[model samples]
Target: MVGPIGNKFAPIGDPGRQAYEDSLQVFEEVIQAACQQVGIEPVRADQIAVAGEITDQVFRHLIEDDVVIADVSGGNPNVMYELGLRHTTGKLTIQIGEFGQLPFDVNTIRTIQFSRSPRGLIDARNQLERALQVGLLEGPDLLAVTRIFREAQEGAADIELSTPDVTVETSDDDAPGLLDTMDDVERRLAAMADNADEIAAAIEIIGAVTESAGSEVQKAAQSGASNSVRLSLVAKYASDIREPVEKLESQSSEFAEHMESINDGVLALLKMIQSSSPEDRPEGWEAFLDQLISMAESSREGMEGLNTFGSAAEGLGSLSRQLRGPGRKINAAVNNMRKAIATIDSWDRAARSIRKPSEV
Candidate 1:
């Protein structure tokens, strides 16, 4: 088995550098424990002759190994990248991470999440033993593995395929009457509203975490650390920033889904309102009509908001381009701008052509 420790040793300044070293120590102990649990000899770096750095030769050797045990803690980019390479080789690979450190995207993939406590380490080792057993036998379903190896290397138990349940409490007075019936559009719009609320709340939480992380990193930098310490801290800050930003982007995508559902609901509501005769209208039909109109307006507004957020995200893409230097930045910027403009144009068309109930 090959265990890559590139990210654990990656240059981040003083405190973070020390933290990374400590993490590596913990990683080594855990790996040995896990191997013992599985009845395998714990392989050390010196024994395996693997370099700490992520050289192409090291990566090639890892890919050629019979099995891979990767530590994905701290969102280690190089480790993740190599793990991905290992997956492409269609070998047995096991994933583990520090508790709560797994990326949202990778959380669905079965992983052993460890804590600092001895009991936690033992539990993680047990889990890893089970994973290795299964992985050794099955080889990770070659055909079903993700193009992204890290995703593919995820064990079955870790994948989250469905959304969590949303609970909304209503007082007797606020509950709808037994006789009330909602058309598809009204029902869909209500659902979209609930989803939007959830997404908004998630965004707020992620933003708060990102802000706090940034502040901590800034403080660390200001304390006059050594080069290794500073680099490590900066790298960690970058990784920390990446997580919440990714969550925010994902929530934004969910908002887009909400917008689409609302649009569908509005169109459906408009059609229902247009088709119904005065005799067929319910007792509070006028109220329903007013609500439908309001909902349509809200949907349009929500789409605008989503578009704006998307634009801001697109702006971040420009930063990535600029960091890469001149010629590359222009192409990336152009491509990004083109996509942004296209999305805006599509939203413009959607907004302008949304049929009013009266028109329908």
Candidate 2:
């Protein structure tokens, strides 16, 4: 089920209202596409048979719908209230809104961001579809999990504060010197490898927390909550994802550069092979083939890493659509990385074909 359809959510004006109408129309498109992507029957309150009052219909849908899509744009109170009702049931729900339109309270949630422009609408639809597929498969109750964890942490902190003189012991072996710290880079990398399986899990948790905050923001906005209150709610959520997005942007850019360097080297070797006679072929061509094989393997690994970080960055970006933020940079970085990977793979294949027994 989806909500805040028609003019009830729009502002009272001419061009401004028209823009909202157009954006909402596009959002509906996103919702329909999301249903198709996840292979679910699309049901919304507006679509239901008018067997009774509209309120009753909305009430039933809020509690019973398999999935609920809420548009929190313009701080629409009705949609926010309906979304809150859906949450109480703990059923699957997804939130979406325009860039810079969602309330700061709900801004922490990973909303599928859209623009009023033609291009923006198309991008929003595609993103909403992907998000639905993921949400359905993962069954993330990010809001619920975050709330439980937050309450638990608060309770634990209270208990610790009340209990004085609580201490733990550490061994001399646990201490690391400057040399050990300097040499820990490889160990850190190894630990990252070991922790690879946890990336998706961590992303899920972060997304849930963000989404939870978004819902709260929506609710508070509807209640005419102050800016300070909303800002406070999002502070922790923003900090949680912001640093990761920045780090990802840096790493992905560096990775793309590496791939470009490798790409240039491979093209040079390929040109050399194409122009050379068999007798005049580079002496170390055989060893170069081995290195190419290694680079191909690394490229594949880089692609996987890019994909993982890209997904997280995309969610974070959706959370905050500032021009310099991860939401924008993540997409560019991911696209560049993908192009690089494809080029590298093609070059790998070409190099291997040249090294074939028939070619020799």
Q: Which one wins on lDDT?
A: 2
Per-residue lDDT of model 2, residues 1-360, tens digit only: 554555444567755567556545754677676668668866666667777898888888788777778777776677777876676666677777777787644433446666777787777777777767766776754453344346665674332122324333348887643334323422432333333323334445545665786798899899998978776666655666666545555555555555554443455455555456669875666655555555555645544445544545555543433423645565555555455555555556666766776642
- Model 1: residues >4 Å from true position, as ranges? 1-13, 39-54, 143-360
User: On residues 197-307, what C-alpha lDDT tens digit does candidate 1 reach at each position?
Assistant: 544454455456546755766777788767676556545544544544444445445544545444433333334434556576446555555554454445444333333
What C-alpha lDDT values do all the predictions have? 0.50, 0.58
Model 1, residue 251: displacement in angstroms? 25
In model 2, the Cα lDDT at residue 31 comes to: 69
Q: For model 1, give the RMSD to the true fold.
A: 19.3
TM-score of each: 0.38, 0.41
| Lowest summed lDDT window (length 10), candidate 2 | 159-168
